[model samples]
Target: MTQNIKKLGYFLLFTFVTLILYLTYLVMVQGEQLARHPQNQRIAAQEAGIIRGTIYDRTGTIIAETNWRGKQGERVYLKQDQLTPFSHITGYVSQRYGAFGLEASYSKELLGLTEADYLENLLDRILNRTPRGNDLVLTLDTVLQRTALNALGGRRGAVVAMNPKTGEILALASSPTFDANEIDRPEVWKQLNQDKLNAPLLNRATQGAYPPGSVMKIVTGAAILSQQILKPQDKIQCPGYTVIDGQRIKDNRSHNSVDFNKAIALSCNTYFALEGSKLSWDQFEDNFKKFGLSATPDIGVPVRSGTLAKGERRNLSQLAESSFGQGDTLISPLHMALACSAIANNGIIMKPYIVKEIRKPNGKPISVTEDSLWLTATDPEVAKQIAQGMVAAAKWGTATAASIKGLEVAGKTGTAETQGNSLPHAWFVGYAPAENPKIVVAVIVEKSGSGGIIAAPIAREIFSMALAR
Candidate 1:
């Protein structure tokens, strides 16, 4: 009995020692992160004396700033009247609500509290003077952003526009956006949180995940071409429906027989389903990963990682459905824009960024963002082949609504079928001036009708405005 009691004592002592070691590890490694977390009210209290930075659009128009009244700084959003359009981009800052969006993402820099400025901060503290934060210049175009917001017509969805070659995000807009200026109010904050259906606070562009519908055909087509499973001239017969693993997957209409390019233009699900069945799961998944479809995007704000079902877990019918974008695969509007950008950029996907530069309050630039490559999805020639099909899609196929009068737009449309009787999500992803591609835009209208009818037109307006600029 004494030996057993001694053993219990030893076990308790070991567990206590392990707990101390873990606490020490956390303090040594994650102390700074824990302190800077948005939920940590200590940072907010400390920042009361600091003047937060101003945020500007690419054209130098102020979007957000802190107005000083005596020694107190009041965070103000300049375009609060047009609330929803800029809400997700600027986010909200409140001692009560903490911070969100860009405000939270760059809190240290915006508060003049980065480790690099420690000496300067100390000196300012010693002098009892408030330190002004560095201002941020974003790549977002206010005019284009507003245009996208208006184009959505107040639907529940998102729009993401970017420079395909440079990777500068021109606009990121999510509908049903709440007013950041009013988010600090207790009642308003409570209402926004309780309204789960609309989810006005969610950044749908980066955070919302939906099944990628027919738009995923782009990845499948690229993979099919890259693997030489099918040549551009290779022919396939697409019946209205194709049976796989004892389940039938149907296309909207039948294309009697089509070459590779024609199949993509028509978005023939039957053709893609058959093609998908031919490739091994590893080959199929590798192509999607190459485009970074299932990865968390590196950007200024927080984003949910794109997700797809594991190949090993999916049966033949499930794989066929996924091949046409109807499986368990889900992605964001931002990711779809990048996929379109890869084809537009000669197969190179540039890392998308929103911030253009950081400047001191005196207007001296401290840091400027440079364009960098994120991924090489395919060879230039393969991208050309995909572009040809996308061009056909925009010109005379399902995505004709996105075509501009003088510009050759290359695009793909998706009408994703959803469960529980709700309307399918409409999707359009494309780039304008196909040969000399300038802008890539992705649009999705939740529970909307057809991609051709609803989403494509919205992208057309954004493209026209962007190219006009």
Candidate 2:
């Protein structure tokens, strides 16, 4: 009996010690996170009292700042002088909803809570000086962003422009945007939340997903060339439609037998369908993954992955539709832009970056982020061939809509058909100055009949403006 009592006593002692140690560790390790819990109003109140850092553009234009009004108890965030022009990039920060965008991504540095900032703060404390939040400079060009936005003129679509060599997003514009200033108004917020047509809140550039249409042919061209089974000069016959497994797939325009250049230039559906079937569905899927279609870009923005429907290629008709960028493939404008950048940068794709540097209040660079390659194409030669084909597209193909005098632009246009009474989605993805690309632009117009007519024109205007700049 005494032994059993002693054993029970020892077990109780061990349990007590374990509980104490666990409590101590929790207090030491996760105490900060616990203290900053959403339910803790005290922490939020304290944060609301701090003077947040400013966000600037590449040209040193203030995009966002926190101003403390003497009359008001809390600090107010003025985004671009309380305007909504760059609201999406310089997202709003409210005590009620925490933070977002540059504010949220660099919150640690903005709040002087990151390790480096903490160390600096400690040093400042030792010297009896106040530690201030750091500023973030972005690669976004405000002039380009505004130009792209104004070019849309209330149209429902998106425009994304990136530096092809560095993958720095110069401009990202989504039309039907709302002003961030109205977010604090309950009545305006309720109206915005209820209105579906004026999905003014939607960030169409990254979040909107649509069937890539023929713009996907860029990927197809790369895949076919990489396999070494097809040559750039390969010839195929197009009889308006191709039949496989009793299914009939028709091209947008009828054409007779043509070579590879003519097939791509004319955007002949029948020719590509035949070529796509020869590659098989598995091979097509693998190549799609290789083109970054299976995953989203790591640009710290919300992006939807381009999807490929799962199934065996039963026959030529299915292959033809998929080859011409139809069937179950869907993609976002941002993803397509990056894919084009891959070809423009000679098979090497650089990861897209928005924020360029973080600096202390005194303008001392705390940290600088450099561009890095994200993916390399299966074959450098194949990329060159595709780039040539895209150049031909802008020169004499369906993307003639994007043809600008005195500029060699390589591009592809896509018109993806969908079910229902809605028109097909129009797409254009391309890069400027064919041999050495400086800018890559991807434009998408929802429910537009033809990519060449709808999306290409927008891209042309953007390219012209970009070159002029």
Instruction: Compute each candidate's TM-score over C-alphas.
Output: 0.94, 0.87
List model 2 lDDT by residue over 1-469, tens digit each. 9999999999999999999999998899987756544444664554454456778878898777666564223333333422366666666556555554555556656766666776777776698654457888888887777777776777778899999788799988887666765566778777867888857767788888778888888888777777765788877777788786687887876778666667666777777777777887778888887777777775645678887765563345656577778877778888888888888988877878888898988899988878887777557777888888788889988999898898899989988898999998888999898877899999988786899998898888888888888
How many clashes (backbone atoms < 3 Å, residues ≥3 apart in a chain or on different chains) does model 1 have? 0
Candidate 1 per-residue lDDT over residues 1-469, each given as its tens digit: 9999999999999999999999998899998778667877877887788899999999998889999888899888866336546789789888788888888888888988877678878888899888888899999998998898888877899999999989999999998888887887999999999989889898999888999898998888888888888788988787789999899888898898888788878889998999887877788788888997877876778787777787465788888988988888888998898888889998999988999898888888889999999999888888899899999999889999999897899999999999899999999999988989899999999999999999999999999999989
Q: TM-score of model 2 relative to the true fold?
A: 0.87
Question: How well does model 1 score by local distance difference test?
Answer: 0.88
Q: For model 1, give the RMSD to the true fold.
A: 2.6
Q: In model 2, which regions exceed 4 Å deviation?
A: 1-43, 70-83, 119-131, 311-319
Q: Which residue pairs collide in model 1, if any?
A: none
Best by TM-score: 1
Candidate 2's displacement at residue 431, Å, is 0.9
lDDT assessment of candidate 2: 0.77
